[model samples]
Target: MRRRFAVLLAALALAGCSRLVETDQARLCRMALPALSPPDSTIEVVGQHEFPDGRGLRVVYQLEPPSPALTHFADCRFRQPGRPLRSDELTTLAIDGRPLSDVNLYFLVRFWLATPEARDADPAPLGDVADLPRLPRSAAYALQQALNGLPLAAIYALLAAAYSLVYGLVGRINLAFGDFAAAGGYAAALGALLAVGQTPATILAAALTLGGAAAAMWGIATSRWVFYPLRGATGQQALVASVGLAMAIDEFLRLAQGNRPVWVSPMLNAPFGVARAGDFVVTSALDALLSGGFALLAGLTLLAAMRFTRFGRRWRAYSDDPLAAQLFGVSPRAILAQTFALAGAFAGLSGFVMTIYYGSVGYAAATGLGLKALVAAILGGVGSIPGALLGGFLVGAFEAAWQACFSVDYRDVAVFSLLAITLALKPGGLFGVRS
Candidate 1:
C-alpha cells in the first residue's frame, strides 16, 4: 500500500512538473513585477508588510545598479481604480545614510476606494487621496475572486455529481462524459444562432432544451450500444471502450465544428456592480448568477428526489448490488439507462450555462473541463454528492486564487499539485468511506 501510494504521488508530481518548463526572462519578469523593472534588470523582493485593516501591502524591493529610470513617482499603482503612482507617495530606501542604487522602492498598495456616494457628498474634500479612508486591496480582491469562483465551482459540481452517479451505478469510468458536455455546448450555440432576435426567455428555453436533448440522446446511445453489450465484461474492458468512445467523439466534434470556437451571445448583457469593499468592486453578471442558481437548484432537487422518491431507492438498491436489485424485481438495465440520462442532463445543463456565461465554446475544451470535474469528484470522494460540491468549490477557488497571484500557465499545475497532496494524505478523499 505504501509503495503504491508513493508511485501515485510521483506520477502526480510528474504530471504537474511537465508544465513548469523554463519560461522566458520577460515572462518571468511579468510574473514578478513588470511595473517595477525591465526584462533585463534584476529586482529582488526584500521585505513585505500588510496593513492591519488589510487595505494594502507594502513591498520593499532592491534594484541592481543601472536600473531603468522610474517613470512613475509613486511606488505603488492602484490597479482597480487605474490610478498612477503620485509623486507624494514615493518612498526611497537608504542604507547607512547612502542612497541605494537607482531607487530602493517601497510600495504601499491600496485595493479599495471610498464609496462614490460618500466622495460626492463630502463637504470638506481631503487634501490628498491618501487621507481618504481606503479598503485593503487584498481582502477585496480575495472576496471578489472567491465570489467569481462560485459559478465555475457550481459547473464543476454539477459535472462531478454526474460522474459520481455513473461511476457508482456501473463501477466503470465514463471517459466520454466530457464529450457529452461538448455536445451540449455545441447544441446550445446552435440554438442561440437559430433563436437570434428572440426574447431572452425564449432563447434560454430553446438552448436548454436543445442542449439537454442532445446530451440525453448521446448518453442513451452510448449506454445502449457501447455499455449495455459490455455489461457482463470486466471493468478494464468497459474503461477501454469508454476511452475509445471519448476519442471518437472528440474527433467527430472537431470534424463537425472545425477548430474555431463557437460564440454564443448572452441573452441578457446587463451587468451591474453587486458589492463594493473599499476600492475592490464586484460585478454580478446575469449569466453567472443564473448558472450558479441553476446548479444549486438542480443539485438540491436531485438530492431530494434521491432521498424521497421510489426511483431513487430503486436506483440506490441497484447501485449497491445489481444482482440483489434484480432479485427484488428491479431491472438493472432500465435503472442504468435512467442513470445515464440523468447524468447527461446534468452535464448538458452545465455546458449550456457555461457557454452562456463565457460567450464561447471550443471543441477542445471538453477534455480539460471533464477532467477537472473528475478531479472534483475524486477530491470530494467519488459518489458523494455533497463531497462533489465541496471539491468543486475548492478546485474553483484554488484556480482563481492562483491566477490572481501568479501566471495563468501555472494554474493547472497548482491545482493538480494540490490534488496530489490531498490524495496522498486522504486516499479516500475528503468525504469517501475508507475500505
Candidate 2:
C-alpha cells in the first residue's frame, strides 16, 4: 500500500509539473506588473474649462503624464480664461480621450474634489457647455460599462462553471483544475514554438486544439489510473492525494521552467484604451473578444451533449447512480474516464484564453483560483449548468465590484466571505435541487 501510494504520488507530481509549461493567467498578470513597469500616475482631473458660448467644450489630457516634466500635463490648457464659472454650475471630467459619461470617472472626480486642496482651490474644469440634469446616466454610458465588464465576467464565469461541472460529475473537487487552465496556455506556448513565424490565428488554433487534447489526455490518465481506483477511499485520503498532486505539479513546474514566467503575445492585439466615465478611467477595447465567446461555446456544447449525445445520456445515468448505471449496461468506469476528458478539454480552453488575455504563464499560475471556482460551484448549486453559469457571473461581478469599491488586495477576502455566507445560507447551494 505504501509503495502503491508512493507511485500514485509520483504520477500526480508529474501531472502538476506539466503546469510549469503553462502558467495561470492571474499569476501571469501578477508577474507582468513587475516586468511591465506601467507608468505611475493615478487618473486625476487637473483642470476644467467652460466655453465662452456655454455650449460644448473639449477637455484634453495625456493618459500617462509625460516624462522629464515635473508635472505631466498636456500643455493644452485654456491660455486665457474669459468665461465666469458659477460655483453652483455642474462640471464633467473626461480621462484620456474618453467621454465624460462614466460613473467611475465621475466618482473618482468627486472623491478627488472632496480633498482639502481641491475643495479650497478653484481648479480648471473640462465641460460646462451644457446644463445637463443630474439624473440617471445616458444609454451610452450604460452600454460602455456593460461592454467593459463583459469579457472579464465571461472568463470568470467560465472558470466557475467548469469547477462546478467537475465537482458535480466527480463528487470531488479537483484542486489542480487551474492547471488545466494553464495547460491550454502551455499548449498555446507549444503552438507558438511550433508555429514559429506562422499567422496568429494558425498559432492560436494550434494551441487551443493541442492544449485541449493534452489536458484531456492528462485528465483521463490521472482519473482512470489514480483517482478512480481510489474512489472508495476516505475524503481525507482523497484530499491529501489531491494536495500531494498539486505540490508535485508545483515542484515539477519549478524544475522545468525555473522561476521565470513566459509571455504569449495576444492572438488579437486589440488596441485597448482607458475610457473616462463620471469619475474613473477604465480599460476599454472595441476589438476585444467578448467573454461570451467561450461561454456560448461551452453552453452550446453542454446543451447539445445533454440533449442529443449518447455519451451525455451515459454521463447523466452514471451521475444519477454508478451502480444503477452499471446495471443498465452502461460502464460507469468508462463514463467517468470520459467525463474527466471532457472536463479537461474545457479547462484547456480556459488556459488558452488566460494566456492570450494576460500575456504570460507562470509556475503557480492557477494557485488558489481553483478554490474560488469551487466556492462558486457550491454557491450556484453543483451539477446544474445554469447554476454554474449564474454562480460564476455572481463571483466575477462580486470580485470586480470588490476591486472597484475597495482595494484590489481585498478582492479575495470579499469572494471568500460571499462563499462562506452562501454556504451558511444554503448548504446545497443556490440551485441544488438534489437531496
Candidate 3:
C-alpha cells in the first residue's frame, strides 16, 4: 500500500511538471509568432500538448491576416533533444472575407519529426479550430475569462457602490472617485512594501489602514477645496469641478509615480482547477473565491450600515429630500462630508483589493475601471447600492461572455450596447425609482 501511494504521488508530480513545461513551450511559441509573421498578422493559440512519443511537444496556432483573405495554419513542435523548432512550411488556406466559413482548419508542423511520425501523432487544435474539441476548449476559456472578470467586477462594484452612495446623498457625481481608488492602491502598495518583514496579516492591516486613510484624506480635500465652494451652484457646476479635480489628481499621480506601473505582491498566486473535462481545464478557484468573498462582505456591510445605522438614515433622508432634511435639522454640509469620507474609504479598499488581485496598479487604471463603475452605478439605478452590485456583476459577466463568443476588442461595444438598450427600455435602470 505504501509503495503504491508513493508511486501515485510521483506520477502526479511528473504530470504536473510536464504540464508546466508544455505551457512554457506554448508561451514561447506565441511570443515567437509575431516576430516570424507579418506586422499586422494576428496569432491565436488554439491548442498545445505533448506528442504521443513523450519526446516532443506540439503547439497548434492560427494566423489570420489583416485582410482576412488568407488564413495560415501551422504547428510548432519542440523536441526533447533540445533542437530549435521552426514553422517554415505553413499551409495557407484562402477564405472569403465576408461571412467566413467555420471549416475548422488545422496546421501540423512536425519540426524535426519525420513525415511518418507526424502522420502517426494527433496534435491538439488551437482556439479557432472546428467544432467538437473547440466547444470544450472555448467553454473552458470562457470560464477562465469569467473568473478573471469577477475580480474586476468586484472592484467595479465597490467603486459603483461609492458612486451610488455619494450621488444618493449629494445628487452630484464625483468624477474623482476612481482617483481615490488609485490613491488607495498606491498607498497600500507602499505600506505593504515598507512592511515586507511583517506577517501577512500585519501587512494586510497596515495596507488597509494606509489606503483607507489616504483615500479619506483625498475625498475630504476635494470636498473642501472643490465641491464645498460649489455647494450653492447647480449640479452641472459641481460635475465640472469634479472632472477638473479628477484630472488634477491624475496629473499629480503621473508626476509622482511616473508613467510606469507599480506591481504589488499577489496575496494569492497559486491557481487550482475547479473543473476539468478531458484536456480542457477551468482554473483560478482561489482567485474567484477571494474576489467574490470580499465583494460580498463589502456589499453586506454597506447594506447593514444603511439599513440600521443613524448615519445611513440621515443619508437616506437627505437623498430623498434635501430641503426637507435640512428643515428637519439634518446638517447637509456634515452629511456631505461624511458621505465623501465613507465613499472614499470604499474606493480605497477597492484599490487595495484590486492591487492584490491584479498584482499591479498603473496610471491608466482609472480609464477602464472608472467608466465601467459609472456604467454599473447607472445600470443598477443611480442611487441604489444593491443595484450597483448587481450591475457590476452583470457588466463583468457580459464582458466575459462577449470575449468568449466573439472578439475581446468588441467587449466594450457589447457592454455599451446593452446599456443603451436598458436605458431605452427602462430609463430608471434596474433598481432606480421612476419619478
Error of 3 at 174 (Å): 1.3
TM-score of each: 0.68, 0.64, 0.67
Model 3 off-target regions past 4 Å? 1-143
403-425: candidate 1 lDDT, tens digit per residue = 88899998888877866876788
Give the higher-TM-score candidate: 1 or 2.
Answer: 1
Error of 1 at 152 (Å): 1.5
lDDT of 3 by residue, 232-333 (tens): 999998988888888998999999998988876554333445445566656663445567777889899999999999998998898889899999989877
Find the 10 residues in a row with the least total lDDT in model 1. 20-29
Clashing pairs in 1: 54-136, 55-136, 111-137, 112-278, 112-279, 113-278, 113-279
For residue 370, model 1's alpha carbon misses the true position, in angstroms, by: 0.8
What's every prediction's RMSD, in angstroms? 17.4, 17.4, 13.9
